[model samples]
Structures are given as structure tokens and as C-alpha cells.
Target: MRQDELWGEDTTQRYDTPGTGMFAPDVVEPAVHRLAELADGGRALEFAIGTGRIAVPLARHGVPVTGIELSQPMIAQLRSKTDEATIPVVVGDMATASAPGPFHLVYLVFNTISNLLTQPEQVECFRNAARHLIPGGRFVIELHVPDLRKLPPGQHAVVFTSGPGYLGVDTYDPLHQHLTSHHFHYTEDGQARLARSPHRYIWPAELDLMGQLAGFELESRHADWKGGEFTAESGSHVSVYRLGPVTAT
Candidate 1:
């Protein structure tokens, strides 16, 4: 998949758009419901709000949410849903785009920031988020903790040929320090789309440093907000940051 096409037109979809294969089965319902609750209302902004998975429900719950997306098709698909037609959708790169207003909470969930490729850009994204929030506001990031050293040197591609042409492909460039994987499902239906989210993985320590460089103070890190301590070798991470020192009232 080309870099531009992968996240742009490929992802803007619905449940039938790909389902659990494209999205992890744990995406919605309790997990996403809990994620929405973290915002706690008051002009929330979600980065890379593809298809309104959490945004729609949060808005319905009266959160007054706004979304920033790079793909117009994704935004169109989001608005196509009756629930999100009226919600604001800003189309631009998340690293530089400004949201509609100062938000109490700015969340970039589903490991969206890893799409930026460079560490500097990721830090810049955090800074932009800081510039968009009120004092004491939050910038929340959710991602899976990556284990790269475990993999062999520059391991590029994991092919599981369980069935005919049903192979999984996970590639990495140790030299470039980036990893992205693609999974393909083939059937009589002809090369169907499964779950394919290719991200430039970063460890929790690296990401936390990026946030700090962007002028944020680490607030908390959880394995999951439902109450899980963030220890080494964890799978998922929910990192919260205080934007900046409060301006005196």
C-alpha cells in the first residue's frame, strides 16, 4: 500500500467497511465507551476520528465533540451516518491543523499519531494540541506498547499461509526504526479486505518524551482506564498529559 493511499482513502469506512477484521474486536462497546467517558464533556476534539467510531456515540451522549481528519473520504463516510451529519469535521493533517475551539480534552486514540512517521512531527502534533486546549486541559493518547527488540534484526514480513493465499505480512526496517504490517484475506469473494492498520510503532518511554518536548507534563499512564497498572511488557497504553502550567486566574 502506498503511504498516501494507506491511511487516506483506504480507512474511511463503516462496520461493513471491514468489521472486526479491519478493526480489533475490542474497539467499540465497553472499550470505546470507556474512552469517551475520559473526555468528560466540554468541546472535545478527537484526532483521526475515522468513521466516528467513538465520536458518534460521544456526541450522542452530549459531549459536543469535533474531529480532525486527513481523509475527506473518511470524513464523508463519517457524515454519511445520520448521527454525525451535523458534527463538525475538519479536514487536514493532524500535526498542523487547528481544531474548532479550545477543548477541555484532546484525544488521539487508536494509535493515530504513529502515522506521522517522524518523531519530530509527532512532538509537533502534541504541541499543536497543547496550543488548542485550555489551561489544565488534557491530551490523551492510546496505543499498544511495542516490543521491537524481540523481533529479529530488520525483520521484514511475517507470512502465515494457513489457507490458500491467506497470509499475514508484518514488515519492519530496523535501520529506519519503523514497523508497519499488512494482512490480506483471500476467498472466492476475491481478495477481500481484512484488518490492515500499518503504524510507525514507538515505545511508551519515547512517546512520553515526545509529549514532554511538546510542553506537556505526564499526568498518568494506565494499561487500561478500567483500572490496569501500566507495567513493562503491557499490550495497551492510555497516556494522559497536562497541557501546560495553568495561567493564573
Candidate 2:
């Protein structure tokens, strides 16, 4: 795979297709709705706020936003939104950037934490968010819980009988605990365009331990804000943390 062809840069163009709102209205709306209430109506920061999907809407909800994003094309895609140009952005890696100002909330949505491939980077991301958070502020993350044990070898793609022609290619290496997924969207012309994303999957409990390592306390957690308990079968994990006072060196 060519380096440029993979999912490293310009995530906005990749994830922000026009009329994409209707693609997963049920899942996206609930997630956004939950985030809005937790925002605290104060200075809020979004790590990897791609194309302003949730950020734009949260801004519309009358909250100020500071975005830390790595890709310029992703930042450009945010401005491409209706009335989203005013949202301030800092173009840098969220794991190491001085995100500026003491924020009441710093959030990473859509499992964006996995974008950082290594465990060290993910830990630093937590520390960075803590560095920018105000006293008693919160750090929020909505991440996917990987079901690796369910996948078996010799499986590349399977067409579901329910027929949107769902094909799932599971690419995971047990040695590294990395998941590289290849999603193929079939066109009417019998061609397919692949959206291959590589992610480092981590369990929810393990991430909580990571937060502890970064001076954050697990404040609250839910399976979903629609009122569900987190279980092994849960598809997603929505977590919240309260940052401890800045540690002295």
C-alpha cells in the first residue's frame, strides 16, 4: 500500500463526503446529543475535530470551540461547513500541542484516539489534554471496543445476506494488537473504492488505567447516554474523566 493512499492525511475529505449526515443518522445524532450536554457551556476543545462534524453542531449549540487537528485538509473541510469558519483551530498533533487556555472540557470523538498508533502517543494525548484543562475540568472520549477474539483467520470478506452487500475485512495482528480495516464500498459499475483505516484497539478498562497514569480520575462512564450499561457486548464506550490538579515536575 502506498503511503499516500492509506488513511493518514486529509481525513476530512475521506470522512466528510457531502450529505454524509444521512449515512448514519441514528448513531451520529445520539453521540452528538450526548456530547452537547457534557460540554459545560464553557471553553471546550476538540481533539481531532475532523471536518467539524460534531464540533460545528456543538458550536451551533452556543459553545465556544478550540480545535486541534493534524491535517490541513481536515481543517479546510471544517471551514467548508455552513457557518463553521468562525471556530478557531490549531493545526498540530493533539498529542503534543499546547492546545492553549484552561478548558472546561477537552474531548476526542469518533474513536480518534486510535489515530495515534503507539501506546506512548495515546498516553501523551491524555497528558496534553490535562495540560490544557481548567481546574476540575473533564476529558471525554467515545471509543470503540474491539472484538478481536470473535474474528478467525482465513476470513477476509463476507457478503451479508441482508444485502447492502456488506463486506468486512478484518486485519489485525495479535503480536501488535493493531487493527487495519479495509472497507469496500461497491459502485453500481461493479467497482469498489476502499477506505482502509489502521487503528490500535484498546479495551475500555485499559484506557481508564491509562487515564489514571495521566492524573485523571474516572468520573463517570456509560454504555451510551441513551441509558445503557457498559457490557462486553456493547458496541461503543463513552467515557468521562476529571483532570487532577497540574502535577509538579
Candidate 3:
């Protein structure tokens, strides 16, 4: 699906169900804390800043925040939360859009980089982040690791989440490093609504290479926003790359 099409009116509205998965306090706090600290009292820019989810709170914490978003619906949803003076957003592609910045930190969270859907586009996103940062500034990304391990011999699909209200599954295409997520939302009337989005699953090492190509070096990587050690068993990672000479991993 095109990036803009993936997040329409209903989808953006459904994204912020307070206390649910992504919007839960516990899920949001650690991320804000980590990003705020990384900002080091400097400005921050968020790529694909959907609904101002992380940006608004980070700004309230005193970090100047700006965003680049491709979806007007998502941006509208964000606007509904806070006025333009609070969080200015540019409606354009994260991989190519420019926001006023030499920001100290630039971040893409919640597996948003995958939305680029191709290796070259994802690499361009890294370059774009580098473009917005000051020397030695950091770029952080929160992405899920591919779960090929869960794909048995010939299976191409994995149901990662299943509940009475929702079902989330991913279908993989290893030949092209693509994965399509299908989300099913159930209503009280026994009707199921579906939303599907495509992503390009990337390996951690591959991401590091993209950082290098964009003139960045790996600074640190963690299993989550809380800074847990990243390991083979981890499902997602928060990786920080700096705009300078390579750092020993």
C-alpha cells in the first residue's frame, strides 16, 4: 500500500485508543524518557510522526519538537491533539521531507522505517535523517526484528497477536524482504474490519550498513526503550546512530 493510503481517516482515529497497546502509559513513557535524554536539551525532529504520539509528550518535557509526516489524516489527528504552535508538522514523505533543523536528535519510532517498503527508500530515510542533524547528532530508530524463526518450514504467515477484539498477522515474502501486516478489528456486532500495510523487514546488521552509508556510526542498540541489552532472542530494538566516525559496536 502507498504510505498515504495506509493511514486514512478511520485508521488515524483508531490509532489512539488510550490505554491500549501503543498508547498505554507504560509503552509511551520509557520512549519519551529515552528520547528526551538523547535530545540533550537540544531540538528533536521526528520522522513519520503520527498523531504526535511521542512528539507532544517530548515537547512537554522541554525538548523542541518538529515532525515530517506523509499522511494528512494522521497529521490532522495530531493537530486535533495540539495546535500548530505546539507541534509544527510538514506534510511530506519522511525519506525526503525537510523540516527546519540542525536538530540534535532525529528519530523514527514504532517500526515506522518499515513503511518505506524498499531497501533504497529505507536507506534514503537514513540519509534524510543525517541531513537534518548537526555534527555528531544522533538518529534513533525503534524497529521490530524479522521473526523468520517463527515461520516454520514452508509457512509464510505468522499470527503474532490474537484476541477477542483483534487479530494481527504478518505474511512474509523472503525473496523480496517484504512483509504485509493484516489487522482485524472486531466489533460487538460480530463484524470484522481489516487494515493492511506493507513493510520491508530489515536485519539489524543491514540497518547498521545503511547508517554507515549515510555517514553515521552505530552508537548503541537496545532491545527496547528501557535500554535492555539487544540479543538474538530480542524481538525489537532501539538503535542509536551518530553522525561521525564509526564507533565500536
Candidate 4:
């Protein structure tokens, strides 16, 4: 499905999990705190700011926040919580969208960058982030490390999430760095539904190279929002890259 269709109205309605899963205070507060600190009292921009999950709370924390979102349905959901005056959002692709000037922080969380589904688009996303940031500003990305190790020699899929009412699996194309996450949701009535989305999984080293191509220097990488050490066993990372002089040719 296309990106917008994947996050259409039905999906948008189901996206917000207030006080649970990604919306739990423990999962969210630390990220908001860290982002506020990184903003350093300057304006912030969020790429793919879905349903104001972080932007609303962060704005409440006194940092000015703007967003770039492609899904109109998602943006509408966001509007239900806050007005455009409180947090203005431009509707366009994050890889090419333009928002108001020179934000101190530009962030893409929850592996949103991977939605671009191609190397060049991902590179453009880095450049786009750089374009929106002031020199010395920071670009932050939170993404998962591919779980190739979980696959047996010939297996191409891994079950990444399994819970009482849900099952999530990822099928991989190693040669193309592609992934399609399939989610199965079960209703109390015994009904089952499936949703799938495509992504291009990226490695830390390749991400750093993308940053460098957009004139950014690696600042720090942590296992989580709380600044935990990123060890080999870490499944995901929150990476910070600082804007520097443009050198991409």
C-alpha cells in the first residue's frame, strides 16, 4: 500500500494507544525530556508527527514544535487534540517537505525514516533535515536494528511482537534491505485483521554515512531514550547527529 493509504483514517483511529504501549508515560516521558533538552529552548520540528503523540506533550513542555506529515488523516487526528496555532504542521513528504526556518532540533522517531523505502529517499531525508536545521542544530532518529540474527539460515521472517491480542512479524529481503511488517490484531469477538507496511531497514554505519553526506557529525547513540549504553545486543537505537558545514558533492 502507499504510505498515505497505509496510515489512512482507519489506521489513524487505531494508532493512538494512550497510556499504553508507545504512549505509556514510561515510554514517552523520557523521550520528551530528552527532546526538550536537545531543543535547548529553541524551536523543534518533527518529521512524521503522527497524531501528536510526542509533539503535543512536548509543546506542553514549553518548546515550540512544528511538524511535517504526509497522512492527512493522521494530521486530522492530531488536530483533535491541538490546533494549528499550537503546533503548525505542513502536509508533505518528510524527505522533501519544507517547514518554517532553522529549527534547533529535527527528529524522526519510531523508525519513520525507513518508510521512504529506498536509499536515495533516505539520503534526501537527511538532507531535508539538514535544510531545516540551523548550523549546530541536531537531527535525531530512533530506529530498530534489523533482527537478521533471529532468522535461521534459510528463514526470511521473524516474529518481532507477540501478545495477548496481537501478533507482529517482519519478512525481510536481505539483498535489498527491505522489510514488510505484518500485524495481526485480534478482537474480543474472535475476529482477526491484518495490516502490513513496507520499510527499508538501515544499519547504524549506513545511517552515519547518510548524516555525513548531509553535513552532520555523529554526536551520540543510545540504546533508548534514557541514555542507556548501546551495546551489541541492543535491538534499537536513538541516534543524534549534529549539523555541520555542508560538504556533499
Candidate 5:
């Protein structure tokens, strides 16, 4: 499915899980705190600011926020929580859409960058973030490390989560660095539903190279929002890259 269709009405309806999963105070607060610190009281821009999950709270924390999102349905959901005057959003692709900026901070969280599904697009995403940031501003991303190590010889799929009501699996294309995540949800009424999304998994070093190509320097990388150590064993990371000062010839 196309990116917009994948996050269409049905997905948008089920996207917000209040006080649970990603919405848990423990999960949300730390991220908000870190982002607020990065914003440093200046304006912030969120790439793919779905449903105001972090933007709303970050704005409430006193940083003015603007957003870029492709899904109109998702934007509709976000509007229910806050008005445009409070948090303006430009509707279009994060890799190419321009929002009002020179923002102090630009962020893309929860592996959203992988949605670009191709190397060129992902590179453009980095450039887009750079375009919106002021000199020395930061661009933050939270993404998962590919689980290729978990796959034994000849295995192409891995089960990342298995629980009473849900099952999540990822199938990989090692040659292309592509992945398709399948999520199965079982209702108490014995109904089952499946949702799948495609992604282009990226390595940390590769991501750093993208940052460099976009004129950014790696500032910090942590296992989580709380500044935990990022080791080889870490499954995901929150990486911060800072744009360098612009110079004239």
C-alpha cells in the first residue's frame, strides 16, 4: 500500500492508545523532556507529527511546534486535541514538504524515517530536516536497529512480539535492507485482523553518513530517551545530529 493509504482512516482510528503502549507516561514523558531540552525554548518542527502524540505535550511544555504530515486522516485526529493556531501543520511528505521554519529542532520518532522505503528518499529526508533547521540546530530520530542477528542461516522472518491479543513479525530482505512488518490483532470476539507496512531498515553508521551528507554532525546517541548507553545489544536508539554553522565563500 502507499504510505498515505497505509496510515489511512482505519489505522488512524486505532493509532492512539491513551496511557498505554507509547502513550504511557513513562514512555512519553522522557521523550517530551528530551525534546523540550533540545528545543531550548525555540520553535520545533515534527516530521510526521501523527495525532499530536508528542507535539501536543511538547507544545504544552512551552515550545512552539509546527508539523509536516502526509495523512490527512492523521491530521484530522490531531486537530481534535489542539487547534492549528496552537500547533500549525503543513500537509505533505516529510521528505519533501516544506514547513515554516528555521526551527531550533526537527524530530522524527518511532522509526518513522523507515517509511520512506528507499535510500534516496531517506537521504532526502535528512536534507529536508537540515533545510528546516537553523544553523547549529538539532535533528533527532528514534529508530530500531534491524534484527538480522536474530535470524539464523536461511531464515528470513523473525517474530518480534507475541502476546495474548497481538502478534508482530518482521520479514526481511537482506540484500535490499527492506522489511515488511506484519501485525496481527485478535479481538475478544475471536476476530482477527492483519496490518502490514514496509520499511527500509538502516544501520547506525549508514544513518550517520546520511547526516554528514546533509551537513550535520552526530551529537549524541542513546538507547532510549533517558540517555541510557547505546551498545551493540541495544535494539533501538535515539540519535541527535546538529547542523553546522553556514559559511560564506
Candidate 6:
């Protein structure tokens, strides 16, 4: 599907449902705290800042936050919450868009880098973040580790999430490292609605290589924003990369 079609009006409208699931206080606090600490009273820029989910709150914490977003509908949803002066945003692709910056932190959270859908684009995303950062500045990414181990031999799909009213599955093309996440939300009357998005899944080591190519060095990697250990069984990670050299804190 086209990028615009993927995050168009209807998706933007339904994107935010505060204080539940991924929007829960507990789920958001760790990321906010960690990013705030990284910002260290300097400026921050968010890549693909949808509906200001993190940007709004981060700005309220006193960090000057700017964003680059491609979807106007999503930006409208954000503007409904605050004005441009509060949190400025540029409309364009994250991999190529330049936000006026020499920011201390440039973050792409919630697996947004996967939205680029190609290895070259993903690498460009790293370079874009580097371009916006000051020396010793940080670029962060929160993403899932492709769970290929869960896929039985010859099986191309796996159900990653299911709940009372929703189900989510991922289909993989191992040869190309491509993935498509399929989500279904059920109505009370038993009808199901579906949405799908494509992604190019990269391994953690591959991401580090991209960062290195973009003039960043791996600073730290955690299984979560809370600084949990990333291990063989961990399914996701929060990785920090720094421009030039940084002594890990």
C-alpha cells in the first residue's frame, strides 16, 4: 500500500486512545523518562511524530521538541492538542526531511523506522538523524527483534498479539527480510476490520552497522526503556547511538 494510504485520515482518527494499552501511563513513562534524561535540557526532534503521543508530553516536561511527519491528518490530530509554537513540526519523510536542528536527541520510537520499508531508506534514516544532531548528540530507536524463531519451518506467519476485541499477526518474507503486520479489530456484532502495514525487519546487529555507517557509535541497548537487559529471548529493544564518541553513562 502507498505510504499516504497507510496512515491516512481514518487511521489518524483512530490512532490515539489515551490511558490504555500502549497509551497507558506505565507504558509511556519509561520512554518519556529515558528520553528526557537523554535530552539533558537540550532540544529534541522526533521522527514521524504521530499525534504528538510522545512529543506533547515531552514538551510539557520542558524539552524543546520538534518533529518531522509525513501525514497531515496525523499533524492535524497533533495541532488539536497544541499550537505550532508549542511544538514545531515539519511535514516530510523522516529519511529525507531536514528539521532545523542541532538537537541533543533525535528519537524514532515505537518501531517507526520500520515504516521506511527498505534497507537503504532505513540507513538514510540514521544519516538523517545524524544530520540533525550536535556532536555527541544521541539518536534513539525502539523496535522489535524479528521473531523468526517463532515461525515453524515452512510457515510464513505468526500471531503476535490477541485480545478480547483484537488480533494481530505478522507474515514474513525471510529471503527479503520483509514483513507485513496484519491487524483485526472485531465489532460487537462479530464483524472484523483489517489494517496492514509493511516493514523491513532488521536485526539488532544490522541496526548497529547502519548507525556506524551514519557516523554514530552504539552507546547502549536495553530490552526496554526501563533499561532491562537485552538477551537471546528478548523480543524488543531500545538502542541509543551517539554522534562522534560518547562515554556510556
What would the per-residue lDDT of candidate 2 be over residues 165-206, giving only the tens digit for each residue? 446575777667688776777777788766677778888878
How large an RMSD does model 5 have? 2.9
The TM-score values for the models, in the order shown, are 0.83, 0.85, 0.97, 0.96, 0.97, 0.97
Compared with the true structure, the alpha-carbon lDDT of candidate 1 equals 0.73
Q: Output the TM-score of candidate 5.
A: 0.97
User: Per-residue lDDT of 121-156 in model 4, one digit per residue for the tens?
Assistant: 999999999999988999999999987999888899
Candidate 5 residue pairs that clash: none
Candidate 6 has an lDDT of 0.93
Off by over 4 Å in 6: 247-249
lDDT of 5 at 209: 92
Misplaced by over 4 Å in model 1 are 1-4, 8-26, 83-85, 159-166, 189-198, 245-249
Tens-digit per-residue lDDT, 158-200, candidate 1:
5533567566766776666577666676778785767665567
Residue 152 lDDT, candidate 1, scale 0-100:
70
Candidate ranking under TM-score, highest first, comes to 6, 3, 5, 4, 2, 1
lDDT of 5 by residue, 3-111 (tens): 9999999999999999999989999999999999999889999999999999999999999999999999999999999999999999999999999778999999999
lDDT of 1 at 126: 92
* Worst 10 contiguous positions by lDDT, candidate 1: 13-22
- Clashing pairs in model 2? none
Q: Which ten residues in a row have the lowest lDDT in candidate 6?
A: 240-249
Summarize candidate 3's per-residue lDDT along 1-249 as a digit string, tens digits: 577888988788788877778888899999999999999999999999999889989999999999999999999888888999988999899999999988999999999999888899999999999999999999999999999998988999999899889999999999999999999999999998989989999999999999999999999999999999999999999999999985656
Error of 4 at 194 (Å): 0.4
